[model samples]
Target chain A: MIAVMSGSFLQRGEPAIMDKFHRTKAALSSGVDIVLELPYIYAVQNSDLFAQGAVQTLHEIGVSSLCFGSESGDISRFTSSYNVLQQEQPAYQTVLQKNLNLGLSFPEASRHAYQQIGLATSEMDLTKPNNILGFSYVKAILDHNLSIKPLTITRIKSAYHDQAITGSIASATSIRKDLLSKGHISETAVDALPDVTIQQLHTYKKQAGIWHSWEDYFQLIHYRVMTMTKEELAAIHGVDEGLENRIKKTARSATSFYEWINKIKTKRYTWTRLQRIFAHILTSTAKADLQPFINAKTVPYVRLLGMTKTGQSYLNDRKKDMDVPLISTLAGTKNPLLSIEEKASHAYYSIIPGEKKQTLHHQELKPPIII
Target chain B: MIAVMSGSFLQRGEPAIMDKFHRTKAALSSGVDIVLELPYIYAVQNSDLFAQGAVQTLHEIGVSSLCFGSESGDISRFTSSYNVLQQEQPAYQTVLQKNLNLGLSFPEASRHAYQQIGLATSEMDLTKPNNILGFSYVKAILDHNLSIKPLTITRIKSAYHDQAITGSIASATSIRKDLLSKGHISETAVDALPDVTIQQLHTYKKQAGIWHSWEDYFQLIHYRVMTMTKEELAAIHGVDEGLENRIKKTARSATSFYEWINKIKTKRYTWTRLQRIFAHILTSTAKADLQPFINAKTVPYVRLLGMTKTGQSYLNDRKKDMDVPLISTLAGTKNPLLSIEEKASHAYYSIIPGEKKQTLHHQELKPPIII
Candidate 1:
């Protein structure tokens, strides 16, 4: 079966350890037959848009099912939650606004809204990170009236935000922390990651000379905010409510990326939301750039990052039915979304040292992996 | 008599070793009566504009004479060169265009134009940095029909671009290089600087924790160019002729500010010109921001950075005759040029560590120094 996943090309303004090529290769080596890159604009956004873009891309490519890991593994419960939210739309939105006006973060406000609408139950907890994402996926599928069925596997061994690696099946956060701190994948992290993932991590570290982290980009972001005027910062995507002034002021004294974020954070703005804003700033992604694609019925194109022999056959069988362009090589493609992806790719690899930087950057132009 | 010198507030994109307050104090202590800041937009620019802005500000404040150091110390030679250029305007323009089209930098092309028009003489070598600026000052005085007389002192002991400190009268470049490298005023640098200047330098380093250098800003400029699209960069002041593409491409592989400049340098673009462009980029000074002041007969205002007792009396006597405002404090001041200066000041002090950063940045709002 084809496997669709959100690649961490850049996750919340931080570059991922494994680049697109290596990650695709790892997935194909594992059991995944096909790998399609979720466009960067969607991949680096909040959960609702992220799920919508993924669901829409899958529907366009004629996928029949979508499976995700979540705290609530039962599929019917997610559907019930989605239905309850749909039935109580007015009340839900009103409660959401009230909680938000009371200075709650979006996630916290949404959870409050859900509880206020009586959707909280012992069998289903939507507060978990994976469950929240799964709920978004189910909502997107139902809202778009796509013919894809939702599936889930219970997440185990570690919590979604877990910072310490446990038995096996550790959260990505813990694994990244372990690998970055040790300068290589430690024994505990190796236990959690598949063999292919471990190999990819090793290869990426050796070739890139550094693992991508928030600190790697601290100087860049600080310069951006420090140099930008209030109006310019306001023009960036997700910089609202005079937040530009705060960012500009905090950037002057912030010694590190974490410190800057903490200084700017308040009860209303969550860390994740702030990270997304910073991601947009680093990418130079303006609000105008995302305006057209915010509610796009379908993504303009589906980029195939890699494919196995079986995945190639599946594409060959379904090529005619696909309506949108499937881009593999970026030599001359001109879609706006694809252009943003290319720019983001350049930014992602801009910090790599020596000749390896140019080599990795030029990877944007090469054809996708076929194994 | 009031002493006027170009403050190294930020010279060609590098932060001055001494900030405005300390430099003003140094000038006051070393027998200068008044220190008026040449607006940052003009200070960090090329020679013609720098001279124009300084001459204009001095004229606005009713200064009777402008004195500058030059290899060609005789002021009459500058006047003769200016006269020849004025008489041979058409021919000079043609030869300058031809040399530029033949891929020569502006300064080199202008020198060739001078020779081609038989304006270059053994008595006055326009190729020298001080002579070039002296010529510009003479031209500005004549062109604007201002009442200021131009004077010159023969520069000795060190060339304009000297990188080593020697003797009592060393170039500012050499002193900066020495101090930055040694992390203090070396005995050699001390000899070049006056006792007051040495005291200020030590105080600045003690409080600021580090001396400012181009390397300190390499990361910032690198990040700015890396994240900015070609279109966005082209909009910055002095980024033209598709140089944005070169800058964007070179930023990817460049490891430091000097390396990036060297990589992007061509025969047609001089090192100084590139530094000016980078200064503009770092300050986020757009081409549109400078359009209003480019050919204006007078600057909007003259900022008083500091004054001694005699200087304060001079200002009191001349204040009534002044047409434009003499701004002492930034509180509630509203002018475009002042706004740009404020923004640039923030960028200049952004790299200072800890509470010192905010303290220095807030100096922009503080009243001018009176000693």
Candidate 2:
């Protein structure tokens, strides 16, 4: 119930209506005892990092659950598969390697291998939706060994990647698309967005989604991959066995990741497994690094998004008995992940409530989310 | 196995490989027997229509077992849902009325009421990737009373609507994004598409996702909703109550279907449920019309996406006992859904092989899937 805020969520981007100060104030306005701000260290990174920062902030503050979304809202299936993944890593590895040997791309191989071991296809087709975010949450929770459970508030109809303006409740891509297409959300499309969230459409769309495409990023990623030596490739997030050479050689001819996968997929190798490998590389994730987080327990913190008046009172009463820190902000930047994420947050918001830079001032008054 | 080929399958949008000539030929090549061409009528429509058409075709030809995807991929969840939906009509009606009283849209009310009554909310989350397809299969199976057993292929990793391309297998949106950015797919992106599929990248990128953003066709849907009259709406695929009015009004403000849903959603309204309404309006389905089919008792035949030599032989040996039509194609049209679907199949291929305006006649050839 404790309301938490990621103050100054965007720099250069529009500032959140309730900066951490406003959000925290708003939370307190509900008559809650106190509001906490997440450290700037984690607030400004990519979504996964953001999720981690937000979740970690709350966990440290002592929260019991982390609600999120997934393509298939079937929690049991998600849990089953997740557990299976944890329990049968060796078998999965065997299948993964076999599929790769058959020339399958990592993603596809992973998907097919999962299916062979009993799972649903298309039902949670990661290739078409916001599955990465879903997985990121799962991975974060698993890696952190948090006691806070994960729940999801399933979203309505909309493909997460759709990059065209259709109606309201657009895919971030669509919102960004419309923003870029007209350099502003059409007057009509505004109703679909919360007043606080609209700048998301206005800013990212106006700057990044409009001016550049994933294609623009491709070459950079390719360069990153190409420049890597064998050791570096092996050190990348998902690199295993001889994949570094394959990626290096493939980088020479493959202009897009899509082309590279087609060259790799086979009967045994599914597209999803290969895609994961690429993701690991793009994010600089190393198996060695990830290995620790795979099954580790994530601690719980109450990083609040928004809370009602009644919710605040609940948090105040409960805070005394909590086992973890009720964190409002990071006291210092100790973790590299947190620091880097904090730095990156400002760059992404260059066009929103257009801040020139990100700041870490103590926030005591800001709130956009309610309940 | 008898292999049937319909000349119009290519026109319906299915890969020619799915056509009787191609499917059966593929089966034959794989060493199967007895490929019958599904009447052109039932072979071309969408899942709903295809279900009806396939059921009728099977009944006429005598077949058994229809396999499909279900989100939970568990019989208990699927069956439990079906039983509840089937038996709780009266309670659902009462809940629907009360929700509508609160100004909730029919779809919103229906879903909310269902959730209130302990129906699973995850099933109601429309943003789920393959949920609609799975639900449709369920509805079709129930309506047709066909003895087809549903089988699901396990999906791993990504959710259906995810936009961020991860692993090696990018979402179709990412593929289209890559295509849109490059005008033509780079070798990397091209490799992501099925090697045999055609491409119409610009069209896909412009719309968002293939077969996903059909808002342009809303005028037709809206017109049908507005002019159809209550009785007609009731008869339409998913219309119930006076939702017809809300749909018409929403259409006026709605720039897109997704927008329309926002205007119309309420505690009772569900997006998929709403989608079903539109689908019904377009297809002209009715509860009573579907009632008899839902009570059917046997599967018609197995629809093959592709098969290997062993797969073909398995079918060949089991054809007679299938107790349904083992069709592959049709020389002429028979069902409206199939016809519509047949015409629409080409849309999915709009971003792969870089083709434009695929012709029906050209859909006849068959090629190995090259697993």
Model 2 lDDT tens row, A257-319: 567678765454345445545544544445554443323233234444455656666667877
Position B363, candidate 2: lDDT: 44
lDDT of 1 by residue, B106-174 (tens): 989989988888767779888788898889899999997888888999998889999887689888888
Question: Which one is best on TM-score?
Answer: 1
TM of chain B, each: 0.97, 0.50
Candidate topping DockQ: 1
